[model samples]
Target: MRLAIVLYPGFADWECALLMAAARTHLGVEIDVATADGATVTSMGGLDVSPHLSIDALDPAGFDGLVICGGTVWDTAEAPDLSGTIRTFDRDKRLVAAICGGVNALATCGLLDRVEHTGNNAASLAALHGYRGQTHYREQPQALRSGHVITAAGTAPISFAGEILRGLGLGSEELDGFLALYGREHVAATSAG
Candidate 1:
């Protein structure tokens, strides 16, 4: 299946690295990167990446799902209005995944209002101010999924990836195997320490 990943300047690198790698290796999913302008965008860690398409140019129907990577910009005035694209994915019944500050896009678009979700924190998400979906927020430890939306805190990329794989219909055994290969210890350690 083909998936579209949205990246902005300062997008989080860790959020999708393992997911992208494991999904490619184990699930053979095809991925394309998109940005507001189809220009080269840099991650928060200073890695440069060129987007495969611009948001306006990407056809929602061409992708099986959409994944949004978080960055500080999601919380800023510079954030792009992704509501239309996100809504299209929702209408099409495709998976919509967001983590950390990327959750802001979902929140801003009114998608989080109906589905249970978690983010960097309640406050960061609450700070979205005009969003009327606060009551739908759940105070989970990390990842949360409701309907077609998958959300996680910035620090929970592994769990985030797990939730996304689960949404992709990967069997529990396959998820367990994939996690054992790359997640078990890290998840345990992160939880413990």
Candidate 2:
């Protein structure tokens, strides 16, 4: 399977780390990173990533799915408009996943209008000038999936990864095992203080 992952300035590197790792390690999926412009971008955590292509250069038909990483850039009026790209992916029934501020891209495109989706919060999304998908928002504390669209809150990267793995058609047994290991490590680290 081929997946297109979008990146931008100040993206949350942690959000898609597990998903990309598991996808490559277990599913053997091919991932191509992209950005609005075909250039290197920096993450919120200060990691630099060079995208394989620009969003304008990507064709939804060439990939099996798309993943939009969250960033502070999503809230800006100057952020690149990816609505057309998202619409193309959705029209083909390809998996579309977003987290945190990334959902703002989907919201801006009206992709969440009729789908059950969760993000930073309903209010954060409602704050967008032209967001008309408020009624379809879910107040879940974790990830929620509706049809081909999957969304999650900023703090739920593990849950986000689990759902994306599910979208990848990874077997439940494999998914559960990976999540169990991830959860244990995460809990251990957070509780070590």
Candidate 3:
């Protein structure tokens, strides 16, 4: 499967990294990183990522799934055009996943109105007031899945990617093997903690 991950000027790096790792390891999926512009995308932590495709150059039909990473970019009142792009992908039946404040983009495009989802925090949940399927995943600690939409809380990129892998029908054993092969200490830490 082909996955398209959208990047922006201020996206979260860990979110992108974890999802890309999941796509590569569990499903052996081809991941194409795209940006609103062809320019290098930078994260809030000053990390720079080069996208494989520009938003204007992307074909919504080419991807089996699309994930939008959240960060400071979504906190603004001015809506981004990327929301429309995500909406187009959703209309095409591509699996759409949003992480953290990325839900803001989905909300702005009206995609979250009746779709189940979760966000960064209580304020983030409040922001998605018009959304009908909103739920808090305190016990599980991550908004893993809600129908076709997969939403995750802030900084939970690893779990978010795992949920996506599960949604794509990749077994947990495969994900565990991948994590082991990749020397991902975070999983170990999570398990131990």
Q: Give all TM-scores, in the order shown.
A: 0.91, 0.92, 0.80
Residue 22 C-alpha lDDT in model 3: 61
Candidate 3 stretches with Cα past 4 Å from truth are: 128-140, 176-193
Q: List the RMSD of every prediction in angstroms.
A: 3.0, 2.7, 3.9
lDDT of 1 at 74: 85
lDDT tens digits by residue: candidate 2, 1-193: 9999999999999999888888888779898999888899999999999899998987877998899999888878777788999999999899999998899989988899888899998898998866888888889877887888999998888889888878867759868886888777556445455
lDDT of each: 0.85, 0.87, 0.72
Report the Cα lDDT for residue 79, model 1: 86
lDDT of 2 at 137: 87
Clashing pairs in 1: none
Report the lDDT tens digits of candidate 1 across residue range 1-193: 8888899999989998988888888789888999898999989899999888998876767987799999879877888889999999999999999988889989988898888888888887777855667788888766898878999998888888888888888648868776767655554444555
Q: Model 3: which ten-residue window has the lowest total lDDT?
A: 131-140
* Model 1 clash number: 0
lDDT of 3 by residue, 102-177 (tens): 8677766677666656667656555544544344333346656765578887767766887777766665886766
- In model 3, how large is the Cα lDDT of residue 2? 85
Model 1 has an lDDT value of 0.85
Candidate 1 off by > 4 Å: 186-193
